[model samples]
Target: MSTDTQHGESSLLIQLQHGLKREQFERALHDIRAGWNRRELWMTLGLHDVRQRYRRSKLGPFWITLSMAIMVLALGLLYGQIFGQDLHDYLPFLAAGFVIWGLIASLVNDGCQSFILAEGMIRQLNAPLSIYAYRGLWSILIAFAHNIWVFLGVALWFGVDLNWNLLWVPVALLVLLLNGLWMALFLGLVSARFRDVPLIVGSVVQVLFFITPVIWKPEMLPGRALWLDLNPFYHLVEIMRAPLLGQAPALANWLPVIAITVVGWAVALFFYSAYRWRVAYWV
Candidate 1:
């Protein structure tokens, strides 16, 4: 908070700004790039998103969690019976998946539209494109935190045991957030070039939801379990669900998930860097 510290920080950021624009990919890579107080940026952007979301509603951010719970209840009651799954066990599984999926869906849906949605601020202020994407990511995380209330409710309602595996929940969330950030950076940058990119992402999320195992269990797939390996969403859902279910994913499950997220993240950074400068003008 000292003037000296502020000056040093500004100088450092300026250096990054210069290096960032040296090429296309690096510019977008600047946000989550290591050694730049990444935690602080995440926390700051997260708070900004929360404030914006609650600014309109009197109950503010709690509404996000509340809305998420309602959706789960509605879907679980209907889909549990339709799928012939018992609501007692099924509701808890569905609750965990619902909260995590919202984070994924929001990241993709909002990432595809992050910059466009933040246009007024982008144009009026010297906002980093990554910050805009972070807003979307933060909003989802906050909502996920709120929806976690359902985790408790579901367990108690079904008389499920709260296990030590629940401690791994944060690790799973980090994986989800990392993937979400990549989606936001890559899609947000590209979508700016083609206005329809947002619409396309929206449609894909809808189509993929049915294909992915949200309403049902992965065990329902029969011999096609190998096919589930191909879905990034499946791993994402499993990462969160496994922990709460007291069956935390093995290294085999997570090694691949981490690899996939890293590769996708690198690709998105490339696109973001390649297109970051033009984003201001595009919006």
Candidate 2:
């Protein structure tokens, strides 16, 4: 072919690539909207997952509450003595932070399997892939509901003050859930293609729990520390934990949480739009 003919073909290919990308982006948005519109379906599936996990058990889902309560009590006693902190203050803080961390961690860990574990459904069903993400998030939220009571009990035991700021807990949870949605979709997509991603994520989350001030306090740091500010998990926990402890989250915390949410969704949607259709095949 002549130089001009080859150049024209290249230009045509570029145009087609852009058009394909635009089409994929539109379908991605539709999948997200359609999945949300079918909330009732995912919600039921999520609830069934929770029940199925505890079927034939005496305590059912309340086992989550019992297990969390035991963990909070054990950690509170051990760490309170180790850190020389008063139980009254420390337990409530630990409980609030730990429960919030549970939700965040579970959202991430289970989010990896959001598509992988739904392999059968992905292959056999024609539902939007986002529904699997939603189902995983809802299951995590159900567990969070069970675990929140542990924090409430700790608050009551410690005589933690309740104030108008407590109202922010719901708003904080709503924001966290928004973040979780993207996390599930993004991580689920990646994990579907790379089986090892979930293992890596699980290990990372375990390490983060130790360093993110769940069983400890940020104030324990002797001086102004940069790592605490840089730790997104710290900000995430603080956003919810502060409200539960009857305080407004610092502007510092809100800024990072909001920034992460916006950036996370943008990245998640870009990849999800580009590769969502491949999830079925990847799984």
Candidate No. with top TM-score: 2
Candidates in order, TM-scores: namely 0.82, 0.93
Q: Which stretches of candidate 1 lie over 4 Å from their true place?
A: 1-58
lDDT for each candidate structure: 0.77, 0.91
Candidate 1 C-alpha lDDT tens digits along 1-283: 6355557646535543653655545544554454134456656766876777689787788887788778989999999888899888899888888777777888789888878887887888754667777767777777777878987788788987678888888888887888888888789887886899889889988887877788888888777677678887787778778888788567767877889898998787766665667677788
lDDT of 1: 0.77
lDDT of 2 at 155: 95
The 10-residue segment of model 1 with minimum total lDDT is: 28-37
Task: Score residue 63 of candidate 2 by CA lDDT.
Answer: 100
